[model samples]
Target: MAFDYKNSPTDKTFMEFDRIAAEMGDIRLVSKKELIFIPSMLQEGEQVLAFTCGVMKGKRWLVTLTDMRIIFLNKGFIFGLKQIVVDLNNVNAASGETTMFSGRISFQDGAIIHTLESVWLKTVLPFSNKLRDVIELRRGMKEEKKTFSVEGDDFVSKIERLASLTEKGFLTPEEFEMQKAKLLRE
Candidate 1:
């Protein structure tokens, strides 16, 4: 069942939604009310990947993983909505622990740690593993972009970037020197 939201989904969003349903098991762990409300909180172009209903600080929350970030959503009895968001780029690590019946998932970003407890044990491993994998993939892509940033720069600028990359250990000294010589010859 599709929930109504502010914007219509694009083809990319539909593909991602299908992938999430196939891989993560349809997000049935959260409530129907939550399902109805979640799309409203999502930014345009953001795709929901996985989610688990859990407790934190004695309040129930629906912890959701999206392509762009992690969202902790709670609708209070008296109050309206309380949400905490952790950007994908800010996630330093993800870990989980499972007991006989339930599990806990924790995400550490810098000095802060966000944890959701009482998740179904079956979802713990898959969710945590996917979280870690996504973080690694995003970081890898960012590094690759950085490595190719010297493109379109002037000759002197390219050599300076190579030197900087060498200093940062992204390039070896020999590789930097070789590239510098190649650029000089051009």
Candidate 2:
């Protein structure tokens, strides 16, 4: 079944999420509720991608995904909050699993091994997919940048070598131009 954010049983929680989203001008609220505890934990420039509320190890917990990190907020009955932030760069990989009545998020250094009611799974599962995609995309971009830098350095060295060869009369100016064009194309 499709998850309708507007009509979820957690409508009140969504209201709180909306308030926080308004205050944070650039952020898009992927999902939110009292269970997620996002407003209090989110950092500046971190965009919420997905979140869910549930219980883990007998303690109430809020699991959240943001552009830069994955966070777990353990809710206490009184006074304090325990927060765990996993930067996206440190996450080697992430995966999600769901049964009829619960969901799990497995990632580097930690996992959200809790079960949400089946009604909530529709929303949570898709969020998990989106989070994984974002993480993979960031990793791919970093790899591409590294490859491009290496190629750029190689191109510069080749040009220098071609210039030296021309000066030494090992290559004519026409040959140098042709080699330069070939390098640029590659």
Per-prediction CA RMSD (Å)? 8.1, 8.2
After superposition, the stretches of candidate 1 with alpha carbons farther than 4 Å from their true spots are 1-22, 25-27, 150-155, 158-186
Worst 10 residues of 2 by lDDT: 112-121
Candidate 2: list runs displaced more than 4 Å: 1-41, 109-120, 163-186
What is the C-alpha lDDT profile of model 1 across 69-154, one tens digit per residue?
99888887766888888899999999989999899999998899888899877788888988988899999999888767745456
Q: What is the C-alpha local distance difference test score of each model?
A: 0.78, 0.64
Compose the digit string of candidate 2's lDDT tens values, residues 1-186: 323333345565466556544443324434333445564556654566666555555666666777788777765665577877778877776666777765565665435333323224454556567767988988999999999999888889999999999999999999999999998888
Q: Clashes in model 1: which pairs?
A: none
Angstrom error of the Cα, residue 64, model 1: value is: 1.0
